[model samples]
Target chain A: MTQNPQITPEWIAVDCSATQMRATAMGAAGPLAQATGETSKDLEAALLCLIAPWLSAQTTPVIACGWDAAPFRAVPCMPADAATLVDIPTEDARISLRIAPGLSQTNPADMMCGEETVIAGALALNPDFDGVICLPGLHSRWVHVSAKEVVSFQTFLTGELFSLLSQPDDTLDGFDPTAFEAALSETLSRPEKLGAKLFSLRAEVALMGLSPRAARSGLVGLLIGTELAAAKPYWLGQPIILIGAPGQCDHYAHALRQQGITPATLDAGDCALAGLSKLRGLL
Target chain B: MTQNPQITPEWIAVDCSATQMRATAMGAAGPLAQATGETSKDLEAALLCLIAPWLSAQTTPVIACGWDAAPFRAVPCMPADAATLVDIPTEDARISLRIAPGLSQTNPADMMCGEETVIAGALALNPDFDGVICLPGLHSRWVHVSAKEVVSFQTFLTGELFSLLSQPDDTLDGFDPTAFEAALSETLSRPEKLGAKLFSLRAEVALMGLSPRAARSGLVGLLIGTELAAAKPYWLGQPIILIGAPGQCDHYAHALRQQGITPATLDAGDCALAGLSKLRGLL
Candidate 1:
């Protein structure tokens, strides 16, 4: 929304979501610079605003994941890497762009775009790694990976529901840990009462003098706890790696620890850059 | 929200909600006239706008329910009647305003404002009736009425969630029955998968080409089915009465029928008037 600073590098890696796009300028050594655009419509215009200075006449390549038009590849396949990129015709002659295809499952009808690239980077770093991978964000995914291939996955609407229920101005800064843990345990035991439990927050505020912080925390715990109940099979005993923002991963880690799972975590941005770098090697 | 039409009556009954207020004028025999205002924030002004002609020097009594400030009485109590009315001093001497208190439950921390008056009307019409009462609205309630008292009740956020997830302009006229019933059955059997099932609607649109109508129907079925799954104890083999908008009651009836229960029903507006009329008897 403000003036973007210029950054020039050999290539670029961009991860796009509905509300934001983050680009990492990549040099042979590693990430040389970064830029972010908090925008939705006219992605090309937004990207140009942030990354135009990096373009050159040498035909600089830009690899992107999470375009709305990206094809969804059926699961029981490998994570999207360089081979999955489809050439995108652009107005700029100096820009050569391609987007990595996302993944889809037919039975439960699940889809995702950027998380696959992160999974690719994780696998690239650990060639023989196999287990469950949770990429938490607006839509959190629990993916099953084996022998460098994504077997199948499920997506939970917990993050989206939390956003919808909480006040828009809320940033989860001063949430009550005690209220959160209490509500978490409550929902984990009585997941059936989720519908009723949601309304109680509003009632508690009116009748019991519940603070907004506690209510927000209770909402988070209730949603995540119910998700944990449903996703029991996914994380009950599986070796898990949570890939996301550090704060988000910490919340998930707390819940998983409650269920007796010690999950290793990787920074989502780092994995995205690593994944794109691995793809760049192929390009 | 339109030009006033003049008609005089003995007293007025009103059901006030955040979005709309419906007022009914009562005569010696039965209802005489009606007015509605689709507005909020200024309830006294909205009421006067709709019923100013009916107010006169004799000091017309206004029996109102569902005002936000109405106190909530605990359960194991009869529906709100004349005794629940709390007087409000107004600027005009012609208006004697009173609001009937709603109901609350302590353990679950639930509250209701308008539905209690509707329940009172249903009870007034059938003094000996004892069973479950379902009031379907934005925040639906299921009540356990036994021996002329509300033994306990539960509130479901299904309707609110439905409105939240649905397109603003959609009226649910063209929803797919097959998809609705199928989704209902799916959640009735496996309600734990609700968090995943919600996201599936969006995924279905992309990967499966699910029509918006079908998606909307699926959402309704999913929420209702999950609520039914949780509320099995309330409706399983128990005689039931549904009091709300006819269309909303019909939807609840359809799902109840799947569980092999047929419910007796009442129009919500009629019940609100009958309730207020019953309360007016004491005045």
Candidate 2:
């Protein structure tokens, strides 16, 4: 053999997404081997291959291996079933070595079923987050993560509303997201007096003849301000960590700063990876 | 005598837009008089001909006057020098007539230029109305009409924002307007807490995953709640008079009852017309 390799295929951390596989091999001193990330049409099989590259050649003991709730999510899982481990057989040449799939709990009946990963990742960033964490996306989430867990959360169709308002036929189709973000910052600074300013969008137009696009931005700003005022008491002195993309992070950061609250932002994908890694460490 | 008879040419009020004419006249009012409405493609000249067959060749003051700010707005006289006038013309014809052209005392740049007209119209309905008069529209004017003049007022774009937010693609596109109105009533019942409810729109959607349409209605309720709160200080134990269209009247009535304000509604169009008529009295 090649000088008798002494690498123990022990702890494995995997983040299997819809189109990608990211895996890391760890030993006693943390990350005994390197990590590999790949774009894969078949994330599960690819993940297995990444975890145990030469499973049949060696009798390495896999002490512990954990994965995020991305793979094995096609089959619906129960709420109480999240983080549960399921055994996968080795006879399947596709994977080569035996592996345990991570369980994901989702309420199929609910409007949103598979949102636990992001929330879990967001929670991992702040274990003591007792208030709301607004995750802006195509389907925005206003999660009330508290008591060291996500107790409850709500999703507003803000992203969809923004799309509609910015669509070709909508009254405010050509709104500039940059200017709107600036306006959002302006509103956050004086949240208490925002209730009166919130209604100024239309007046700024019909009365003062502001541009339709500017009106749209103003409307978005007003709504964001209203949101800050509403969630203020719940998370007053607590840290508001915005988990999203770069631009969304800046926008949300500006909003929080306006309300005298500094926001902590983390790349959503990176956060997801880190969270999975943290969970892997526990095992 | 060549029939110098009673020629009622129609006591019509014509608002000539750039491309259309909004003419309202009563039959007893004359040739241009029919009812309040808007028309394009020469409806005004047509209406004049429609009643021409009835006039008995007498010199009845057609009263073909326009209070709009367009150049040469008068039937025979044309718009005067706008720069020289004490008050500049407002974009909306009504505002031009309310505070600037007719009253001449209001600040040309201020938002509440024509607030007195609604106040006067409300006073015409309830002479003892010494407190607040809530006028709902593009720019809702909350005025203190005492001693036959507008004392002070604040403008809220509640109606416009509600319309925008409740639009088909807005946050509340498919929401039940009736239920939204009901919620508004419930919210307005406790006006003091309106500020807190303002952010519930985004929160309910983010936390509870409310529908885009439902979220829009939630925003309306929130905005109306804020409006009620802003108007509370001016309540002064006087009867609240809501001036807007039928739908607006119902919404405000529900909101007022919720706030323990017991509002008396006046038709928006009729009040507008009545306000014009009040200006007529002043003339």
Candidate 3:
């Protein structure tokens, strides 16, 4: 939709993940229009694809998060508006773009890009919320939150490992829940066996005719379960909210359930939008 | 070396790995001629690339191993003359082709292809010897041998994991030995931390300015160390021998040395030839 003289978007919220970038034209009420595209294109071109139609004579401030835009803010700091926004110059005349930096931790070096904005959104939505927030992705992040501050965090390449070892792409369907749970328990209990466990999956197929569904599910369970074992310090005995895509969150939630703990879930895109809006309001 | 009338090859030994195929023409003394090519080529043509010149009017047997050639021979059986030679049909009139079967194990469900032949050769070279044989590869295999029999074996996809997580292919050079040792020790003690440990390598690179050599070496160490932790049952209280490419065997040997265990090393292709020649002698 071209700029409707009648309705002007106050600002646009953009989230640039490692693979893709998305933008939403936000009015005072909510999102007026949205556009999504790959990050592989020229960054300016990608941004214009969304905001060109919405551009007005008045500079449209674009609050963006992701793509490792700026230096990370070390943790043990408030999650809400944690980063100092770095103003990014634009080629377009009417676009005023700014990027929110990601977060980092020193002790066991870890970092997060878009997730920090999502975490900021979560903290802004529920200021009193304190505990753990897990964002599952190619490299799943487990974060500790207390009194609106991100205490510490850890990252796991489990998602990446699963994809490479198994299908290289996974989904919600075609996974055996039973196999998933069994694998979850296996790795959680005997994590050292993980080295051999992955190969055993192939052998099982060659020897036992393990179904594709079972193998995929088992891979998901194994990697997540191993992550849980490592992140026990962050997750166990702490309330958790998994903020990510629904399908992965379902698996994380189920895996946590097996350990007698249930985690709340939130859509990452919504949280990112909320975060951008919240950060914009502060500006 | 085109069908040399002076040095007639009695038979040819071919070893086809997942990615490449190699053949060595054997005379009464030793290898008469050798050639290597990609397995992606037609299997018969790849074999003929080396054997074509050596081919004479008289039938010259080609004893081949690898490429999961025939059905696997289950273990708790002698690695020596373990598999029945599966007669393979060949298009070339002078090519009398046969493939030695690989080995498989029940319970944990594991399998090995070309490495089985290497094990046979190791045993043939030293009859009445018994212990554990570690054949490291994309899928490293650890075999338990007693009285010339492969009692049991386990496979770890650590090499595959390292490739997927860090570099898809690795070699001996450009790795920090100190970093490697530290990572190996850490994983050997706390294997559960592997999920986080992988990311820490990236974090270390990002935050700590870890060198490429250090990161690559650390990854190699961490994966191998964790494998050692899992295969403790196989290596503990048992004499060990590592058979693989020199670069990989060096890393494995060093990792084992850290645990107060020293493993003998051998060239995998050499062992494969020995096993094929020994098996050929039986025929």
Candidate 4:
């Protein structure tokens, strides 16, 4: 059957975080182009600048997601479950802008914006996949997916804390896997000591003159350790799928391997595109 | 017991933190004058300006403590146990500045500068007392004191974390004891979940429209709960004394009371003065 030109897959998927924005242009088979820019004071203007080259004469559907997206429409706690898409009014007539609603958990009162689309894509790819999917980023998500639905999830501030602590002059220079493992074990055994443990990093550097790499690795280990300890219910003996930037996924993968669990990894950008494509197919 | 005129009543006690400096003029009876200033680019100049009026024609001994104090001289782990005082050389002939050394633990590798003097003063006042002294500040310390010595100590970044999280625009309004208590209980029960629990604060505010007061109290509760869980070894069955600013002390007191403990409190400034006075007697 001949396809309708209007619905032949001219679309753009945008993830706009508080600081940065990424857009992927989708053609018939796959992504045509990918662009990123700072999410400036005017998000639309910045987003237009990034995806301007990908625009066509046809009305191209723009699906945006992230914390910076307009107020989220509460969706059911299920993976790959599409929520009502709200239209984002734009000055450009060629653009049909719409934002995907985020996921929310009422009991713990947790929420995820951009990751929901990624989760949708993952679930769509593996319909029978079960267990936890960890999306590591500024706000890391540890989501429980059972029978292709997101039952519940938790968000950790591990990435944000690490970024804040290592900003400007506090950058850690070296990488020490041993130090990271040791710190991970320490935190896992005594998670309550995390508050004191965090400060000890600074003291160690100041007094003991600890190597920058050791400090950095130890910090990552401590944060990930605490997260694992808390997310034990979600990952203990269960398969975990790691999704995020390659560097972050590698860090998580290493951390998990140290704990005797080897998690599967996926690229976050690819996942976002796949998720958006899957959603478009549903539409 | 005739007093030597040269060594008579003139003395200054200064506490120099990373951001600010406070000085008190000590007379025969009590503190005669108090001054404070920003810890500027030139610490010596800033310190001089703070205590210039209190300086005597005869070189007045200025006992200094805090993070800005000279590198600490290692001392025995005993309450009120003195360390070698390091003289801070200055251009001014009138200033005879000597900095008190802070306590350091080798095992966990922790250090404290100004709080050591307060612990000293606390020990001086209660020679027979032996217990945990909680000094709450930017870097809160839970020090175990036994037999007039600082046996060991742990430092928590609770205050610092709270300050950082509440800055710019996220200041929590009002006070909610119930919320604080609830959060404390949650964190104490599952301290490992703290990393995830922290981000939930922001999410709750965004998704659930949680009150600022509740959020503030919850943050305090979560931090203190985790601290209390780790510090159980120090304060579980032991008598506790708090030395810090009244507000911080009160918060610690309330948090402790929730755990079925009534802690005695001493003013940190007064403790510093008393500790310096006791040290002066030794000199």
Question: What is the C-alpha DockQ of each candidate?
Answer: 0.79, 0.06, 0.85, 0.72
Pairs of residues at least 3 apart in sequence or in different chains that clash in candidate 4: A79-A150, A174-A213, B78-B149, B78-B150, B79-B149, B79-B150
Worst 10 residues of 4 chain A by lDDT: A1-10
lDDT order of candidates, top first: 3, 1, 4, 2
- In model 4, where do residues sit more than 4 Å from their true spots? A1-9, A67-76, A81-83, A170-173, B1-9, B67-75, B78-83, B170-173
State the lDDT of candidate 1 residue by residue for A1-283, as single tens digits.
3333454578888988768899888886878778898866877778777787777667878888877666789998888557778898888777788888888999889998878889998887778888999988888899999989999899998898888778998765886888888888887877777888999888899889999999988998898888888888888778999999887788889888887889999988778777777778887
Off by over 4 Å in 1: A1-8, B1-6
DockQ of 4: 0.72
Q: Weakest 10 consecutive residues, lDDT, candidate 1 chain A?
A: A1-10
Instruction: Give every candidate's TM-score on chain A.
Output: 0.94, 0.53, 0.94, 0.90
The recovered share of true contacts, given per candidate in order, is: 0.77, 0.05, 0.88, 0.88
Candidate 2 per-residue lDDT, tens place, A1-283, comes to 1221555545554544433455545565655554456646554555555665524454443321233322433223321132544444444443322233432223211223224455556666666565666666555455555565555444444444445444366653464666576556554554433435544444355455667777676666655654554455544776666776675566556767766778677676665545545544544
Clashes of each: 0, 28, 1, 6
Candidate 2 regions off by >4 Å? A1-115, A123-132, A137-148, A154-195, A199-221, A258-260, A272-283, B1-10, B15-22, B26-32, B35-120, B123-129, B167-182, B185-223, B278-283
Q: What tens-digit string does per-residue lDDT give for candidate 4 at A1-283? A: 2223333347888877768888887777787667788989887888878776666687888887773555654434554444566677889887888777788787787888878888878877767788889999988899988766678888999998788766458654567989888999899888888888988987898789988888888888888888888888888899999999887888888888987899988887777767777777778
lDDT of the structure predicted as candidate 3:
0.85
Kindly indicate the candidate among 2 and 3 with the higher DockQ: 3
Ranking by DockQ: 3, 1, 4, 2
lDDT of 3 by residue, B98-134 (tens): 8888888888888888787899998877777789999
